[model samples]
Target: MMRAFKSLFWIEFKLSVRAMNLVLFGLFSPAVVAVIIGVIYGAKPAFDGAGYSFMAQSFGALSGIGICATGLMGLPLALADYRHRKILKRFEVTPVSPGMLLFVQVAVNFVYALAAMAMVYGICRMFGGGWEGGSFLYFGLSFLLVTVSIYSLGMLVASVAGNIKTANLLCTVLYFPMLIFSGATLPYEVMPPALQHVADIMPLTQGVKLMKNAALGLPIENAAVPVAVMVILAVICVVVSIRFFRWE
Candidate 1:
């Protein structure tokens, strides 16, 4: 089983890489966005009275771009399309289980998101004034929580969507709003009061807030809301995904 899983994972990894458009986007889009924002805003205050610069405040949000792209869209879409085509059904007769296929898809998408995140951090360190966080450890914890939450949510999407078309529609509905308004692609600090109120209710927005607070070395207690929200979201999504998972 271990050997079969390894072989399956390798095949999926190669397939993920072959989709160069998506692979490149996931790997470098965050760095590209970072360059544009860093050039425009530099060390300027993110907003009036905000202690951090725009670049610093945006680092956490920028890191989430690939998460939305892969975890929220790519992962679920790939899994659903496979199911729609009966690829998973073939695995049912083999030693490989449906759970193994799901795991491989999740692993592939997680790799992309992790690579993008690392690139974002490296670019930020080079040109985005670096982070003020006193400890990467706590920031790592925050990143882990956000990643798990988003991917678990993606798993739920795969479990529920009956076909590629449905998955695509669902992803569009969820991804665009999160990508546009969750501060992943925009400056959340400058958003209007009403929009900020709405955006704050989003899990990704809360995750970004959790990340930002950690990056700023702010007291962890200050991020109680986002932390709890992401934790609950991850748990609920994972449970639901497992309960409703479909091989067909």
Candidate 2:
């Protein structure tokens, strides 16, 4: 089992690396955005010494983009392609179980997510000052939570999509709106109150808020609602995906 798992993991990892478009948007996009934001706001003071430095906040927000790109776009498309091509069905009779395939994909994509986050963090630290509001541990944990939550949503997407075309369509529908309204592409503070409320209901918005608060080292009292929302969303999506997922 261990050997099979290891082989599956490496195969998935290789396929992920070969996916140039996913690599570009999922990993490099965040890094590029961080560099741009850092250059624009590198001189700004920390927000009254109570909020994140502008660079830090930008990094936190763009991190969500990476997560969304991977979970919302990359994972679904790849998995759907496998199903469409009947690859999962072929694996059913082998020592490598369909569940193992799912595990390998999730694990590989997770590594991509982490690498993307790290790249964004490194870029921001180089151009702006390093994270000024929270301890490394706090920020890391928040990032991990947000990634898992988004990845769960991706699994749900893959579960329902019956073909590659459907997966891509669904991802497109979910991806653009979430990216635009979830405070990933726009600063939340400047949004209109109505739009802010709408954004608040989005899973990625909650994730972004959690990450930004952690980056700023803000008091957790105001962050409790988003934290709860993210946790619940993660749990619900994971359960639903597992229950409904089709290997063939």
Candidate 3:
């Protein structure tokens, strides 16, 4: 099973790269954003009193962008396409289990998201930015928390969506808005009061805030709320996805 899973993962990963959507948005885009920011800001403090480089301050938000692309967009679309083509049903009759396909799909997207984040971090380093002293571990944990919560939403969408069109619609609705308003592509502080209020309601925004503090070595006050929100979202989404998942 392990060997079969690995093989499937490799194949799916290649297919995803060839398709280019995941590669463009999940892998290249975030890294590009990081490079652009690093070149422009180059170790500058995020703000007058922030004391952290702009790259460090933006790390979490940039990482969240990869997750949004690979999780909310890539994962669901892959699942929907597999279902639409009856590849999942075909898997039931082979040594390769349908569940393996599901695992492979998720695993492939997870790799894309993480690899993109690592590339972004490397680019940050090139521009003279890095995580605070002894802070990378905490930053990683925070990033993982956000990734799991967001991926669960992708699974939920796959379970509910009957076709690629529906998956694309759901992904676009969640993906674009999060990228724009969650401080992934845009600075959160620039948003006005009303928009800030609205952005605060988004899970990615809270996740970004959590990750940003971790990356910056800043005090993370009221962290319980964000943690709880992510945990609850993951639990609910995973449960519903399993119960309603369309294997065929």
| lDDT of every predicted structure (CA atoms) | 0.81, 0.80, 0.85
By summed lDDT, which 10 consecutive residues of candidate 1 come out lowest? 126-135
What lDDT score is found at residue 169 in candidate 2?
Answer: 89
Clashing pairs in 2: none
In candidate 3, clashing pairs total 0
Worst 10 residues of 3 by lDDT: 96-105
Model 3 / residue 182 / CA error / Å: 1.0
List the pairs of residues colliding in candidate 1: none
Candidate number with greatest TM-score: 3
Which residue pairs in model 3 clash with each other?
Answer: none
| Model 1 Cα lDDT, one tens digit per residue, 123-186 | 7766655587546887788778888888888889998888888898988898889989998988
User: Which sections of candidate 3 miss by over 4 Å?
Assistant: 94-100
Q: State the TM-score for model 1.
A: 0.90
lDDT by residue (1-248, candidate 2, tens digit) is 98888988898888888878668888898888888888788847646663446777777788888898988888888889989999877876687654566567778777777888889888878876547657567777888888878888888888778888888989898889999999987898889999999888888888887777777677555667777778888889878887787877
Write one digit per residue (lDDT tens) for candidate 3, span 1-248.
89888888899989988899899989999999998998899989888987678887777788888998898989888889988998777776788644455567779999999999899888888887767653778788888888889888988888779888888899889888988998888989899989999998788998888888888778889999889999999989978887787866
TM-scores for every predicted model = 0.90, 0.91, 0.92
